[model samples]
Target: MNRKGAHLEGVFLDFPDLIGAYLNGTHLERTYFRWANLSNVDLANADLADANLEGTDLIGAKNLTIDQLSKVKTLYNAKLDPEREIALREKYPALFEKPDE
Candidate 1:
């Protein structure tokens, strides 16, 4: 299996924290979740293209695919692609861009 990540293209997503913040689907593409803790979070209908959530806790979050990992981040502020970010906003209307909500 090629990991089913052809649609996911990028290198900015390499860590877990950066991926968890934007669980609402606003940043980080193709993020691999190799043992991250995301317990009790609302992740319904989030877009997780190529994220690898091998061992993570997503009990409350709904609409989250088993193969999807929450990924998002910014050096100084919220940084996301124009298209992807916009899509995220449209996808997840319940949860805001930030995860700490």
Candidate 2:
């Protein structure tokens, strides 16, 4: 399937309809999904850095963050408002890591 700009993290899930395209394993690397609905899906190893998921409906997607659910981020309507970035950055300070600090 031509995902326009959907990042198929390798696994093109073949299941029920109500959801967006399936992406289980495709070596996803910083892909953009402007408003894609990814509810209830496994996206481990998917590099979502700098990916613009504005207004994306991830109401049930699993593992958008890293490692375990504990690292979960930007899923199930993850407030993408421009103003939210400030708060998010404040909440997760480690995000601003120096490359060679």
Candidate 3:
């Protein structure tokens, strides 16, 4: 699934298995990813602003920086590398907030 630079705003992806997908530079603003498996996905330069990532599996995701996660609406229950999760939580506590309606 190569969707580099694609505009996917406001899309709803429930439990989608997108492992190893290439989503670099994609526009994922306001997207809903509930319990989705995005492990090993390339998210370099992807715009995840206001995206809902509750219960989303991002473990081992490639090019996934804390800066990108900072812009997301929420990361509650999102699976990430232990160290990365700690760093993100310490740097951006608001991203762990409850999802917005």
RMSD of each: 13.4, 9.3, 1.0
lDDT of each: 0.39, 0.43, 0.94
The candidate that wins on TM-score is 3
lDDT of the structure predicted as candidate 1: 0.39
Runs with alpha carbons beyond 4 Å of true place in candidate 2? 1-22, 66-101
In the predicted model 3, the residue pairs found to clash are none
Candidate 3, which ten residues in sequence have the lowest lDDT sum?
92-101
Q: For residues 17-48, could you state the per-residue lDDT of candidate 3 as single tens digits?
A: 99999999999999999999999999999999
TM-score of each: 0.38, 0.44, 0.94
At residue 6, candidate 3 shows an lDDT of 100
Candidate 1 residue 46 C-alpha distance from true site, Å: 2.2
Arranged by TM-score with the best first, the candidates are 3, 2, 1
Better of 2 and 3 by TM-score: 3
Q: Please identify model 3 stretches exceeding 4 Å from their true place.
A: none
lDDT score of residue 40 within candidate 3: 99
Looking at candidate 2, the ten consecutive residues that score lowest on lDDT are: 66-75
